[model samples]
Target: MDKPVLPLTYEQIDHWIASLQPELAREGFTHAVGILRGGAWPATLVSHATGAVPAFLRYERATRTAVWDSSVPLPARGSKVLVCEDIAGAGHTLADCVSFLREQGLVVKTLTVVFDDLSRMRPDYGMDCRGYFALLPWERHAYTDRYRARWQHTQAGTLGPIGEDHEFAVYAIDLDGVLLPDVPPHRYDADLMAALEERDALLPFEHLPQIDFSRTQAIVTGRPEIDRARTADWLARHGYAHLRLVMRDPSRHGEHPEQVAAYKAEAALELACTHFIESDPVQAIFIAQHAPLLRVVWWDAARRAAKLIATQAWRGADAPTP
Candidate 1:
C-alpha cells in the first residue's frame, strides 16, 4: 500500500525547535551550520534557540564532499559547530560533512528534523521518521498539486470532512486490542515480542476487518516512551510502521499512570487527529474532553464497526486527573 503523505505546519516546526533548544545547549555548540536548501531553516532556528552564530555549509552529494564556499570563513578551530539538516536517510552526505568539518579541526555535532529508523547515521538529535515518506513544511509546495488531487479523490463519496471542523479528517488508531491480540498488562512478556517478530503470530481484532494501516496518521498508545524502539520494530515488521507512534513520557507523569488518557488526548490534539479508533473506554471518554475537535470512536470488540463515542460534544473538566 502507498504510504500517506503527511503535511507539516510551521506550528509543528516551532514545537520541534522549542523542544530541541535545551538539548543543543547541553552539547555546548558555539556555532550552527546548515546544509544547503532543506537544512537552512532548521539550522537557523536552532541557532536562534541556542544563541549560536548561524552559518551555511554546502555538500556536494554526487562527490560526497563538503564545500566551504561562503564568503565568510567557518568558525575557528576547536569551535563547537552543530551541523543541521532537515532529514537523514542513508546519511552519506551528513557523514561526509562531519568528516570534513572534523578534518578542518572544528568540533562538530549534528541535528536533523527527522531520521529514518534504519538509517546508517544517527544524528545527535532527530525525530524518527514513522512513515516511509515525509513532506516537510518547507517542501510542501512541491507536493501540493499531487497531494490535493489525491486527497480530493480519497474524500470523495465519504463524509464531508474527516476532522471536527475541517473538510476532511485523518484517522488515529490504537495498536493493542485493536490491531493485535490483547494480553493483560501483567502478562505482556517476551513471548509476545517473539510472536510479533514472527509476523503471523498475531492477528487483527475479529470484528474490525484487516485495515489499511497507512490511513492512520498517529498510533496514540499508553505505552511508555522507553518501548518506542521495540514497538516501532514490531509495527515495521507488520507493515504498519509508517504512521507516527506516540508513547507516554514516564518521567513527566511518573505518579499518574491512570492519566494515560491525558497523554493520548494531548498527542491526538497536537497531531490534529480528527477521528480516533481506540480500545480503552475510559480513554475514549477522556479523549473527548481534551481533543474537542476530534471525533472519538471506540473499537467495540463485539461490534461489526467502530462505536462513535462523541463528536464536538463539550464535557466538563480539561485538567488531567491527579
Candidate 2:
C-alpha cells in the first residue's frame, strides 16, 4: 500500500519526444504506427522532431469488453511498430498492443513513449524522463458498483477534443494556497471535504456495489511527493480507494534517466483524464501538446483534506449549492 505514485509537471515532462527521437532512427522505424487518441500527440511530437511525417498510426478503442480497442491502422506488412502510451502502468495496454501488432505480422520492434514502467513486459526501448511517478487509478484504484451507480456523465455525447467519452471533469487548485488546510492533514479543504463526504461514491474506490465505472477518471497534482502523498492517503481513507499512486522507480529504465521527468504526462493521460488542476502557472505554459483544454484553478483556500467550499462548483452537475 506504500505506493509511490508521483505526479509530474507538464513543463518538467514535455521534452521527452525530442530526446527519444534518436532511438526511433536507431530502431529504423521510418514508418511508425502510433496508437490512436493518447498516442497521437506523442507520435506527432516524435514525427515533428524526427522529420518522420507519415510515421504515425491512429489506433481506435476496442469495442469489445474483453479486448482493448487499439484500433491501429497498421501497415498490412510490418515495419518498426512503436506502440506508444501515456503511462506504462502494469503494461496491460502496452502488452495488448504489442500482441495486436505482432498478430498483424507487422514487426513491432520497439516501444517508445514518455513513460514506460514495466507493469508487465518490457518495451524494446524505454524512455521515462519524467521523474513523475504515480499509480494509475485504472490499474490500482479500487472500483465498485456503488460508485458506478452514480453516473455523472452517461455515454450519451461526444468526447470532442476534450475526450468527454472518458466521463471525467476537472477541478484544480494550488498546493501552497488552495489544497493545504490550516491543520496538519492540510492537503484538502475541510469545508469542501464535507461536501465530498455527502456522496461517498465520489471517493476513490474500486467495485461499486451496483454500478459499473466503465468510463470515469480523475487527475490531481501537488507541489511535492510528500504533499501529494498526504492528500492521496487522506482521500484513500475517506473513501478514495480508486486513487492510484504513480510510483517512480529509478531502476526501471536505466537507459533514459532524462525521460523519468517527462513521464508525468503519461500519468495525466493514463486515466483518460481530459481535465487537470494545478497551482503552478508555468507547469502548463511550456508544454505544447499537453496544454490547452487545461483549466487553471487558483486555490482560494489551502486545505490538504477537504473543505466545505461551494460544493456545487466542484461537483458541477450534482454538488449542492450550499
Candidate 3:
C-alpha cells in the first residue's frame, strides 16, 4: 500500500479529535503518552478532549525508515496507554513505539495522531483527515494573513489539516465568547479567562456538564500557552476530569489572529460540528474584522439563562449581544 500525502495543516484533525473524545472518555484509559514537540501539543488537546493528564515519552526515531531509538521509553508498570503523535504518516513510528512498549511488557490501548496520514498505514484511533495533502500550499496560508475585514469561517478540518486525510466527527464552535469569551466585558478587562474560572466555580463541575466537553476535540485560540494555561487548567481541574491531552497553542495556529476564527471555523464546518458559539460585539474592526458570525447574537450565561427562564429555546437563537 502507498502512503497518502497529507500535510500538517489539515483541519480535519480537529474534527477527528472531537469525534474521538466521547469514545475515549467512555472507554477510560489510564495514562497518555506523547511523541514530544508536535505530539506534545496534540497530547494537551487530547488531554482536554479526554480530560486526562498525559505524560511525555522521550523518544526520537531520527528517521522514518529506522526503528525506535530514544533515551526515554514508557514506564515499567502496565498502564492502559494512549500514545499520541502530532501528525502521522503511515504507522511506522507508532508501530515501532508499540513494539518497543510490548517488548518492555506494557499495554497500549489506543494509538492516535492529531493528524493521521493514511496514504499507506493506519493508526488504531484518529480522524481520517486527507484534505491536508491537497491543501498543503494553502494549508500554510492559515497562519499567513489576518481577518482582512472579510468574514471567513473554517470548518475545522481543511485549512491545513494534518494526518492521513481521513474523516471523523467534529464539533464546530465560534470561539471568542464560546471558549475564551469575545471581550473582557468591562473596563477591568473581563479577564475573559478569569471569567471562565469564575463561571466554572459557580457550576458544580465548572460548566463542563452544560456543554459537551467529551466531544471537544479542539478549542482554537490565538492565546499563548501562558494565557491559555490558567483557563485550560480550570477546565482540566473541574471540567475535563481525566482525559489525556496536550492543550498548548502552536506557533503556527496562533500566528494569524485576525483570521484565527475563520480558519478554525472553516475546519469546524467541514467536520459538521454539533454547534458553534462566538461574539465580536466588544471588539473593534481591528479585532473582529469579520463580524456577524451566526444568526443568534452571543450572550453570557446569566443572560442566556434569563432568556430560557423567561421563554424557551424558541427564543434561544436571537439572544442579546450584551
- Per-model C-alpha RMSD: 16.7, 16.0, 18.8
Cα lDDT tens digits for candidate 2, 1-322: 1334443433333465566668776766654545555555656665666655344443433431113343444465756656665555552566666676677777765444435343455556555534444422222221122222332232323322222333344222222222233223332355655543433323322221121223324434332353455556655766544645454434442213223223433445444343334333344332213422233232223232222211111357766777
- lDDT string, candidate 1, 111-219, tens digits: 8887775577988888777665565755533332334555456447343322222333456687786877666554445576654454445655546634444556788
Each model's lDDT: 0.70, 0.42, 0.46
Per-residue lDDT of candidate 3, residues 181-236 (tens digit): 33354622647657655644442312321445455545544444566556466557
lDDT of 3 at 106: 66
The runs of at least 3 residues in candidate 3 whose Cα sits more than 4 Å from the true structure, single-residue gaps closed, are 1-19, 63-76, 111-120, 131-316, 319-322
Per-prediction tally of clashes: 6, 87, 68
| Candidate 3, position 239, lDDT | 52
Clash count, predicted structure 2: 87
In angstroms, how far off is 139's CA in candidate 1?
A: 1.4
Worst 10 residues of 1 by lDDT: 159-168
Pick the winner on TM-score between candidates 1 and 2: 1
Which 10 consecutive positions of candidate 3 have the poorest summed lDDT?
A: 305-314
